[model samples]
Target: MFRILIVEDDEVITKALCKQIETWGYIGKGIHDFNHVLDEFNEFDPHLVLMDITLPFYNGYYWCTEIRKTSKVPLIFISSASDNMNIIMAMNMGGDDFVAKPFDLNVLIAKVQALLRRTYDFSTVQNNLEVHGAVLNLNDTTLNYENQKIDLTKNEVRILSTLMENSNRFVSRDEMMQALWETDEFIDDNTLTVNVARLRKKLEEAGLENFIITKKGIGYRIAE
Candidate 1:
């Protein structure tokens, strides 16, 4: 049975959501500490998350990005804020689906089941990219090197994958940003720099120093 995490702040609504989720034959868990959403998320390792746009400490977008930092678990937004911008933002933030408030419980279940099928049914999916001794797990956005699992954000995963996949080539900043599928819409060159710096630090910690080379004025690449 798949576990579901409910991040809704409404006491009565969350209770109902959890009860409904259990009736569908899935385990439902909620977080008491709104500030430590990720803590509960990492601990539970739920297969899917039901997140509300409105919360106590932070909104759903913030938590989505936080979860996207490491796990690519299926996330469905559940909130009354069902505007066009919110839907687009949810998609951009890696949410799998969205359901507006006052929704039918069965509809939510259908979406969750469909997403689960789409995500988990791919039995032959390439979950890892390996170069040298380092392994990058695409599913969870983590780097495995020397028996260590180093967590990576979504941006870092894209950057590293672009370089490694291209092999002996310098990937330009524009290309890097484009690799993420939303360059101007979300990130800039400076943002790329920060992500690369953080990725390099994590890589170094995993004992893979000098893995990425700077082409200065051009872009970056993995030394051939």
Candidate 2:
């Protein structure tokens, strides 16, 4: 289930939003310590964030900017300040959408649903392996990671996708070879090792170091 972080200080509003989030079949968490908002955000690792403009210590904009530094998770601004300036500022501060306060919960839920569907539905509807902030678009055999992109050969894509799909589990050499051979001629054992080594180097260059780990004589695993 997708997890959302609520950064509203109002106890009543926080509780109500959490209940609404649960009813909509999403996980929700509210921040209790305004001073350590970023810490709470990292710990939660939420898929989305709902933040208030005016806050006790640093305000929503500050926290939103902080989240942008490490992740591309969607952020939505919720506040009583509905002025154009606030909305514009929210977008400028890395918020994906804005929800004005004193609003209908159903309407808010609708917005949330649309955002979630737009962001996540397309992937689930199509079975794709995603990892380390990168998406392996199975339809095209392309790897999209943030702003950079790479096209993969059929076998290379299958190998990486399988390892990524079963991340943290050792993918035996035999299993990998079987997957590779599905589309083309049998790949020699050394060929698989070479491909994996190259893939690991590429991932490391893309800032995903230790993405794949070797088990010496056994197999390879996507490192946890």
Per-residue lDDT of 1-224 in model 1, one digit per residue for the tens? Answer: 88999998888888887888889898998889999999999999998999998898899999999998777788999989899999999889988788999999888888888877655543236777888888887766678888898887667888898888877778888899888753223787777888899989988878899999998888898876
Model 2 regions more than 4 Å off:
127-224
TM-score of each: 0.59, 0.59
| Local accuracy by lDDT, each model | 0.84, 0.82
Worst 10 residues of 1 by lDDT: 116-125
lDDT of 2 by residue, 1-224 (tens): 99999999999999999999999899999998999999999899887888999999898899888888776677789999999999999988888799998989999888888777655564575657777778888655567787877766656787887888788689999999988876434598988888887777777777777877888777988777
CA RMSD per model (angstroms): 6.3, 12.9
lDDT of 1 at 100: 94
**Which pairs clash inside model 2?**
none
